[model samples]
Target: MPDLQLLCLSNPLLDIQAVGNEELLQKYGLKANAAILAEEQHMGLYDDLIQNYHAEVIAGGGSNIARGAQYMLPPNSVFFIGCISNDKYGRLLKKSCEKAGVRTEFRIDENVPTGRCGVVITGHNRSLCTSLAAANEYKVEHLKDPDVWKLVQDTKIYYVEGYHLTVCVPAVLALAEEAVTTDKVFIFNFSAPFIPQVYGSPLAIVLEYADYIIGNETEAMAWAESQSQSTKSIAEIARLLIRLPKKNKKRYRIVIITQGEAPTISAVAKSGGEIEITEHPVRKVPSDLIKDTNGAGDAWAGGFCAGLVQGKTLYECIDMGHWLAQLGIQELGAAYPYPRRTFQPSKD
Candidate 1:
């Protein structure tokens, strides 16, 4: 399994998701169609509105993906790096990680509260309003420990979330730099559409350091624009990104761009002089079968990373990613029925 060890660096927050019809939206004083960012004053109003609908509190964001991978992969192979406050939510986040068998190396911040996202879902569409809270308090100093550096050094791959690029640029860059120095395969997710807009420069720098890149259609579009291109398809976007020059092209070998329900394009730098492009068809899923769209991208990344860690070919990785994504969409939140691992862990 290529001696896999993953260091996932991102936020660990609670997601309060509300699912129902338009009447529920009206009850919360929210616009019937769009997602509105709610303040503290709106909490009371939201509480009163959600009384009529189904509300679910779950562990969310990159942490959820880390948890998924931990359960799906071999025991003690996954570790999560982020910051959470020493509050009630923080305690829950820790328990969630432990339950999923993910080791937590989170910094507890006293100044800020635990991070959270208030998600409102109407039919298949959903909106998120996040309060970074303690997640934003993470700094480069948190990654300075020698033990943490060794974890990055020994790891085969580093999976980072693009959302962290917006709130904790310095910390994110620090980890990326260490991953580069240690010669680890750096896999990054582009995350939300708004992330590239807010952290463009830092994200560009991080991309330069990345060995593998994964993103959805909207995030791919935003990243392509940042690269000064006008491509709309994920395949085109992946081609453009792979062709972009880097200082050490030999080390940065693969770029896989996923277009939801469409074929994924993979670009690989060869041992010889050629750059190869391979298109793999996605496994079809019913259009009306989706229960929750949240964390689908993250779940895909986790599946792709699992394949990579298992020494699967690029096509096999894409196939595994599609299968995992299908599993993710079938559930109400991320980390649904735990996935079965294809490879077993060794005692050595």
Candidate 2:
């Protein structure tokens, strides 16, 4: 197995999650299942909701993925690149990363405020409102340092979040180009479904640079647009993504499409100029109940990256992703409490 060093570049935020009943929603005037951007006027409403419910705040987004990878992979094998302010939330984020055993290569800006995401969970569903504050200030210039470049070069895989593509296009493109030149694997998470609707063209450009692409069924349908209906099968979506032309045909090897509570389909490009689709049924754990769905995708990405770093086959990587996702939904946050296990080929 190749020694794996995974580098992730994206936004890191402190997530404040409040779980409540219908009364709590009524107090805040928050519509169920909708993410509303709260203004200063709504601060009191949020505070009241927090005080009414059992609330928990933790590190979220790309940092969550870094934390998950740290828990699943060998020590010092995972590194995160992002920006945060010298605020209390920023300090908390750093402490969380250290506790999870993830290396932090963060740029601290004293002028900008740290980023945050307010997650409201009502039963099985949840909504997120994000402020990309300090994260938006992260530019290509911050990554120009020799040490940062060296980390990129030493890494076997580079993971990117699609949410950062629009704001940090130049930086994302530069890193993707470097990954291509260095023959390092590049994995992309499509992130929220609404992102591609706004930055489809830039996202399309970024997708061309990815070695492997991962997304939920809703995100895939949104990206596919008029080509397929929303109810299309996961396999159909994965196949469509694989057929799409990229910069180098041989470079884009696999595309995995995940459907919640359904089998995940792995679409692989063959050397014989054919595309093959395989389905891996997720192992259902009967007692598992989903408390929050926020970090499920990030957890899946971490598991997939862990497999790839260990030189596991594409099928094995997909299976690892499914397994981790199962563990993630059982908890309130993305990082699940599971013992770290080195990848063994037989487990594939």
Candidate 3:
């Protein structure tokens, strides 16, 4: 593959999604619009989804963002790295990436089976229950491979989802340090609230090296609480995140927080202890048009990174994020609509 502009590190999972009711979610003790790792009790949920409901299997997790971005970017510009078992689901994952035009470097784990996520959709909300089997086997040594490290060096942007922290904090920290040293853009996503609440120490270490931090309001608040800023509002937390001590001082940190149906809030760090904050209202989609809300955040991040790759302004990047998010919500899974729509960056 040629030198890639965007590189992503995440826990890849084959997602089995189905339209379920509130009772189903309650039976599994899952809250709507939340992401959680599946425990022993939830092991049967996947089979239940497949047999009891109308299930749709799709590529999910970091792959969702990678595919979304690859759909907008030039061919071979995006590369993804993750661990997976050489099993049927893993084969499906590789094939899906190939179909989407995203190059991948997957570390094979013989001992563990491929990971899977059960997405139970209730109305427009989705509750995720993930089983991180092979994904949890990713090691720093995999990234140390000459071939993989070279891709890291060639990339302009490095993105990692928070869920990877539980599996390999060392890998994430190493990439963060590399981003600072190479003066590359490092984007971090707070994929779920448990990441900051449960994995605070490692998350803090990696966060200082992040040039961009993206998350929803619930995640932002959890992060604030982890940092002992529990009373801060979302905008204040965004500013605080930007002001966190950073390893890369060449560029100021940027924080973006998305609130469902509310304005997206952003804060950019500036010189002399200043912070620039702005809110971009979301484009309204008719309630009846929403098919699923599973990958809205990933879609937004994908669009934002695609904008960055195209050298668009920050505002334009946010606009692209919103545009992709709107389109993604209309689909049944974490997927964008087919026959891609061309997006023009706003001049105003």
Candidate 4:
């Protein structure tokens, strides 16, 4: 139980990235910078890209953030649960997670094929088309295995992307329930604008258990809009998020919001019931250093979770998150390069 620092449940998918132009994007029916669920027939385009366009494939999903944190923390610190096919792609995903230092507890669906994400990198942005073949089939039943619950019991901190709500809110509720019952830390993020806009019901269920809520300016704004309070300022929104009632009344929660190169805002609940609002600015990345913005939010979530488990202060946690995102955005995918980032917090 002492070995695991974080536990996460996600819908795993393989990422096949290729460089393309806007025309190629339209040809595939994908919008820039959004992850869309593709139809079964859409896989033919992935075949086309692999055969001609020099596609790079790897394990990718919002859960990759936990995998990213494994690189920063000690070995076997992070564990993931997802559904994958009982096929070669499933094997590849397992191998990739191991290589990234993330332990996995996957349910193999023999009837379905492993999922895939066809990423089209058009200059500065990526349009993602995902086929959730086996991933969408993932259910709460998969985690019912006693062995999986053992890992969940060993965990002290849990981090999961908001997207999990769409797949299995019950599973998210299970993890959230653990966070509350055990008085452990549960870190959650609003993965995309659509999640708060469309899946607010499940999001609300998960929020009742979150100790830390992470989101970008757009997601935060969208969430505020969903609450019918669209006009709130960023600081105001974050403050409101932290003040939201939690299922566990004794919990001290916080909300962190990032704005690309702008100052990141954190609303902390003080020991004496004072709500302390802090702003931590980000370093501007040079155009050449900016690789892709695909996983910046996830990377931030991972770094912050790692910091939380290591018992760092809120300010330190924010700096560590920014540092990891800095390293990640310089790479091609959501992952850090071989010379992985050193777990050091930069001055705010």
Top lDDT hit: 3
Best by TM-score: 4
Off by over 4 Å in 1: 1-4, 20-24, 32-36, 44-54, 122-127, 247-250, 271-273, 338-348
Count clashing residue pairs per candidate: 0, 0, 0, 0
Model 3 ranges with Cα > 4 A deviation: 19-36, 39-54, 121-127, 345-348
Superposition error at 247 for model 4 (Å): 1.9
Q: What digit string (tens of lDDT, one per residue) describes model 3 on residues 1-348?
A: 555989989988889899899988988899988888889888888879978997877778789999888878888889999999999778877888888888999999999878889998886688999998998899999998998898889898999999999889989988998999989999999999999999998888898999999999999999988888866588899988887789998988999999988999999888898899999887778989988776799999998898888888888888888888889999988887778788855444
- State the C-alpha lDDT per candidate: 0.72, 0.75, 0.88, 0.83
Ranking by TM-score: 4, 3, 2, 1
**Which regions of candidate 4 fall more than 4 Å away from where they truly are?**
21-35
Candidate 4 residue-wise lDDT at 150: 87
Q: Candidates ranked by lDDT, best first?
A: 3, 4, 2, 1
TM-score of each: 0.86, 0.88, 0.91, 0.93
Q: Model 1, poorest ten-residue lDDT window? A: 339-348
Deviation of model 3 at 329, angstroms: 0.3
Return the clash pairs for model 4, or none: none
For model 1, residues 1-348, the per-residue Cα lDDT tens digits are 234388888888877677756665565566634555556744543344246555666677678778666655777678888889998778877887777777778888999877876677776667666667788777767777787766667677788898888667777777677766767677878887777777787877887878887777788888778767877777667777776655345485578777777777788877654678777777665878778656677777777777777678777667767767777787876866645545332121
TM match of model 1 to true structure: 0.86
